[model samples]
Target: MIKTIAAWIGSYADHPDPRSALAGKIALVVASNQPFYPLYLHWIVGTAAWPAWLSLLSTPFFLAVPALARRHSFAGRALLPLAGVGNTVFCVKLFGAASGVELFLLPCALLGTVLFRPDERLKSAIVAALPFIAYLFVDAHLGEPVMMTSDYARLVALNGMSVAALIALIGLLCSTQLATREVEIVTTEIPGARQHVDISD
Candidate 1:
C-alpha cells in the first residue's frame, strides 16, 4: 500500500501536467498570502518566544533541501549562512534558559545532505524522516501547558502544512531523479544485435 502510494505520487510528479503545476503554484501563493504566513508572520513578527526563533532558524535549511538535491550547489551553499543566523538567533534566545529541549541541527543537516546525494537509498530514507523527527520535538515543546493555546493551534496547523509540503516536494524531486536515472540506464543498454564486439570465447 505504501509502495502504491509512493508510486502514485511519483507518477503525479513525473508527469505533472500544466494544470497540476498551476494548482501547486496557486496553493503556494495562497498559503503565503494568508493573514499569518507560517514562517515569518506567525513565528517572527510578533513573538518574542525562543521556540519561535528556533523555528525561524531552521526554516532556511528546510527550504534549501530541494534546490540542493537538484545540484544547485551555489544556492545550497548560500543557505548555510541563513541557517547559521537562525541558529545564532536561537542560541541567543535560549541563553541562560532551561535546556530540556533537545536542539541539534547537525543530524538534520547531515540527513539533508545524504538525501540530496545520489545513490544513497538508506541515507535518503533517514534524511526524509529527519524533518518529522524535528517536527515531533517542536510539537512536544509547543504543546506544553505553558505554550498551548487556541492561537498556537493555528500556528501548529500552519507549520504542519508547511512541513507536509516540504516532504511532498522532496518526494517529487527524488522520484524525478529516479525516473531520469532509469531512462538513462535504459538508453545506455546495448541490445544483443547492436553489440559491436561480442566475445563469448
Candidate 2:
C-alpha cells in the first residue's frame, strides 16, 4: 500500500531530468502534507477550532505546484517555496511563536535549495532566503496568539518533531539521489568492468 501510494505520488514528477523530478516529487509530497494540519489542530484543541482550520486554505495553492509546473516548470518550482512560506506565515499568525509552527520554515528553506537547478542561483537564493526572512520577521513582530491554546508544550513538541521528521525524509531523498548519481558516474567511467566481475553469479 505504501509502495502504491509512493508510485502514485511519483507519477506527477515525470520529468526527464532527475533533479526536476526530485523537485516535483518534493513539491507534491509537501503539499499533500498540508491538509493534515487541520486534523492535528482538531486533535490538539478539539473539533471546535474553526479559526485554526483556516490553514487548510493554503492546500489548494500547494497542490497547484504540479499543475502550474505542467504549464511552466519555473512556475511550479517557484510556487513550492512561495506557497510554503505563505502557509507557514499564516500558521505562525494563527498559532503564534509558542506553537513552534515557525520551525516549518527550516524545511521551506531546505526545499528551495533542492527544488531549483544549479544554474538558477538567484531563484534558489531568493526562495531559500524568504523562509529565513519570514522566520526573523515572525519572531520579532508577531504580537499575540490568534488562536489561544493552553497546550504550549504539546504544540511545541508536535511542531518540532513534525519538522524534524520532514527534514529527515528530505535528507533521505537527497542522499538517495546523490548515491544514484554517484553510481551512474562510476559506471560511465568504467569500460566493461562489470562484465569482468560477475558478482551476480
Clashing pairs in 2: none
lDDT of 1 at 69: 27
* Model 2, position 159: C-alpha lDDT score: 90
Candidate 1 wrongly placed segments (more than 4 Å): 1-150, 191-201
TM-score of each: 0.38, 0.84
| Model 2 Cα shift for residue 44 (angstroms) | 2.0
* lDDT (C-alpha, whole model) for all candidates: 0.39, 0.78
Residue 150 error, candidate 1, Å = 4.6
Per-residue lDDT for 78-195 in model 1, tens only? 2433343344234323421132222233333432453333554453454445445554554344332322223544444444565455446545654665676675565569565224
RMSD of each: 12.4, 2.9
Residue 78 shift from truth in candidate 2, angstroms:
2.5
Leading candidate by lDDT:
2
